[model samples]
Target: MDANGHVQPYIINKNMGKPMADFAPELPKKNADGVPIVEPTDEQKYMFDADGWLLIPNVLSEGEVEEMREWVKRLHFDPESLPDHERTILAGPTQRLIDHPVVMGMLNEFTANPALSSQECYGFSLGTCGYWYRTAPNRRTEGLKEARAFKPHNGNGLYRLPGDVHFYNSFPGKSFCPHMRVVWELNPVKYKQGGTLLVSGSHKAVYTAPDEIQDPDSDVWTTYECEPGSLLFFAEATTHSAHPWTNEENDRIAVPTLYNQVDGGFAEALKPDEKLLESMPPLRRTLFRDRYVANNVVGADFKRLWRV
Candidate 1:
């Protein structure tokens, strides 16, 4: 208490840079040459970058869908009939999705540790393989256009602390999101009937969500209508939730899986069963590789996913 003998409050925070500015995110539709050249994922990149989500219609085949349905139903309803290892979302056929090329190709930008991927060490990790089945509740009353709309959660806001992987940052021709979800519906999601609910562009929100965006009752939220086997990719930063299965005709059967950067962990994700791990082939096994690439704890760079 020398000199002035006064007190001042102390505050500490990140000084990453100057204050951030919000801007329009829509990419250019056309170029100087009229219609510009587009790659297979260019459209997807645009949609996902702008809205944080996109649906690839009908990725699984009819037979594949049916097979999955059989397994899912048997596992859910008649678990005793199948072995314990087959009781998981990663059971047999679904295991192929652990390293699906479509997911790897599309989400590589979002979840891959680029340097690690370049080293061919399988840069992405599978967070969870989920088979979600939901049915409407009993005792339905008057006409309901939208009831039981899913609650919104997990959006990336500017005030988040450092070391947060469930975040989104984008630049021209590039976007970064370390955590993403891929939802594959084995049953149809009809319009306003029920599906995954999302706020179109909330992944890049710079401020807290407004009342309208937060309320499922508000029409500001949106959902999709797709055939069975339709797939969707969305960043973890995007606020999303699942609508109830209003269509009692067929119960909703969706396999929504989360993927992430191999070296990071978000949401306290669980590891797949040991039996499931042992049964996988080399490539699929990579999705669940132990996370220790920086210091070469598990397998160093230039190594297989399953290291002894």
Candidate 2:
């Protein structure tokens, strides 16, 4: 209390510097040229850079797919039945995806680019992740193009000028992308089977998406027709929308994990409580631990903004 009996509100928050803990993250492997190394073939990288999306067929084995199917059912049927750690930590078979070998190369490569010259070290952060399910044919309209259709969700709108901040660092020679959405399909995705719609080559387009291309059923928008174990990857800057399930026979279940620059937006994922981390191996626990590298103290030192 002050001399006049006017009470002062306490300011409790203070900058504690970095948290004192053994924080380690899966760092990206870089080549001699300082570009992060990715496992995708030259052609695959070209496809992703040009089209903004890539589909790797049969990343999961038959047995693994079956296991995932059952797990999803168990999770959806009575989620509360599982322990808090399993539910929140995403334990059991699902944990295999924390740094799945099939997709980690590209993820590490894309997430490590620097946003600006001021940044230091290179690293990526895990963003939001969730499951999706669709069944049968729906009555809702399949394809309709409008202004709000599949616009870029992050940063200062979509299209940018030549010298503007480019997310995913889409330069001439070093063409690896920055942000990516990884989707693991548990069931076969045949043509018109209700996969996500993507406007081809929209990721790098300098102009706004046209109404014709924005249409869900537009000829420019393409859908994947791959096996159940297929792994789908697309840059967030790419124009995309959900398409209605037109197969009408089987239910389509998919799990999508979004990984982005720690500096960028869309960082919504369940925090791993002590109990959850305790139950995980050191390697897996690294995924949840916020890293502290000497060069990149600001966290934003890393790269990429999803500017259209």
Candidate 3:
């Protein structure tokens, strides 16, 4: 309590320690114009409107990329000792390479950049969970023929079909779970090494042609050729598929991590378990809400302010 007699903002702990309450660090109030003073840059803003992808070149250093490649090679060659899902086994200098300050700093800078709007970074390990081509133990005559033709939809051993291929929608929607994916290519792209194939503007398409309706000669899709250390970011709305590596002798690998704009207000509505939310720091909670809260009034005010 103060001399004015107004109630102070503080919380009492059960252990009887000093009352802890975060009162400072309030976000700047929306201005009279109602437009956020800090908006995304032209290139960042274009991501949401146009192609729905951003390719960052040389995000990882050559040495770091090589270390990741070596790690993947070790994992692939030793089938009996592969790392389980979420279980990481960093060998030799690979562990240090991944945990290097530079790598950590880059990740933090990219994820926390104002252009991304306080988005949460979801990390994925390509070494553990990348899509791979697996052949059946005993190939049938039809399978061999289908493989030779390079058919995209044939359930042959050459290619493993993605579980779902639909337009962007929320979680319940088949394509929603994978809102975004970042590919960290470990190996340098060569002419015929089977890199990921993607349709440049397919993410903007409202409808996807059925498998039976696809034309063999259409140029709707093209393969993504990139160097090691390059990062390819794409939205799940895109019509994309993986090409099989004809060179079985040399393994190709990439790691991907997904992140979404925190300011979009989607994360707040889809809050995980209550326990998890409660455990998070107050600043995180406040920042998340400030960025993600859907303020209908704010939108209306923005329109009136800007006459847009």
Candidate 4:
């Protein structure tokens, strides 16, 4: 327990041997032959540079969205049917979102950071991704005080940077963000019906958000009241919070994806089981490769030790 006695979570692991890779050394500053594996257009680059967030609207058709909405329920009901890897393949109607074209392009630029000539991160890879559903008419927010409607998390606060390196801590043009976030809204998120809330431009802010912005009811925070097929993309450094759902008409289904630089830290422990990998096309399987180990096998210029 902390000094305040509030409940906190911690993990204790006995000291093992040295880590398999030391990621502290700066990457090469430039690679003349280094071309981005995925590319974002000029417009996308501008929007993200100006706001730290971008909304790509209606990338999925109505039919595709419906299929994914149903898939969410099926997956939730029987998660064991598919190995963790195949749960979100990049092919087929429901799985197409695993690497939607526009989304990939944007994530590619953010995770690859061509501005630095790909030095910060060689390329982008999946860190973790998951689906969320808020059933309609659910009273998860019934007892909460209006002031507590949303809870904020992440970002540098009060002019002091966050200790976590992957928490979108850099300014707009620094090293490519260690983490890039993408959220696909499979249901309409109407204003105040509760969607993700973000402090617009806060990813680059060195100061804590003011009281007004933190208030759940305050308009100071930006909330995307978007359509079912819209996508929200943001850097991990952006201060963000979950806005509790108050929608009584329909359930809100969202898939939040976290992509990291090929060399960035990842907290997830699950790797794709062999059966899942063998079943995927080479292109799709590439997303699941263990960055360091896979690089060595692929004859990449830079490879790190996966296990000594």
The clash count for each model shown is: 0, 5, 1, 2
Clashing pairs in 2: 114-303, 115-303, 158-308, 167-305, 168-178
Flag regions of model 1 displaced more than 4 Å. Answer: 1-40, 118-120, 139-149, 157-159, 268-270, 295-308
Q: TM-score-based ranking, best first?
A: 1, 2, 4, 3
Worst 10 residues of 4 by lDDT: 24-33
Per-residue alpha-carbon lDDT of candidate 1 for residues 1-308, written as tens digits (9 for 90 to 100): 11233221121112344322211111112221233212236578788888988989888899989988877777667788878767787876766654556666665555665434532235667777778766655533333223445667878642457687667866554576777888888898887667888888888877777778666667768888899988899887888886766776666777888887666767444567788777665445656766645642223433322223
Backbone clash pairs for candidate 3 read 265-292
Give candidate 2's whole-model lDDT. Answer: 0.58
Show model 2 residue runs off by greater than 4 Å. Answer: 1-38, 113-122, 137-166, 268-270, 291-308
| Residue-wise C-alpha lDDT for candidate 2, range 3-113, written one tens digit per residue | 435333221112243321211132434422234444677688778777888999988899999888777766765678888667631566766765676566676445542
What's the true lDDT of residue 87 in model 4? 65
For 183-230, candidate 3 gives per-residue lDDT tens digits of 666666554346655555555554544553253335765555667777
- Which sequence of candidate numbers ranks them by lDDT, best first? 1, 4, 2, 3
**Lowest summed lDDT window (length 10), candidate 3:** 119-128
User: What TM-score would each prediction reach against the true structure?
Assistant: 0.76, 0.71, 0.46, 0.70
Give the winner by TM-score. 1
Show the lowest summed lDDT stretch of 10 residues, model 1: 20-29
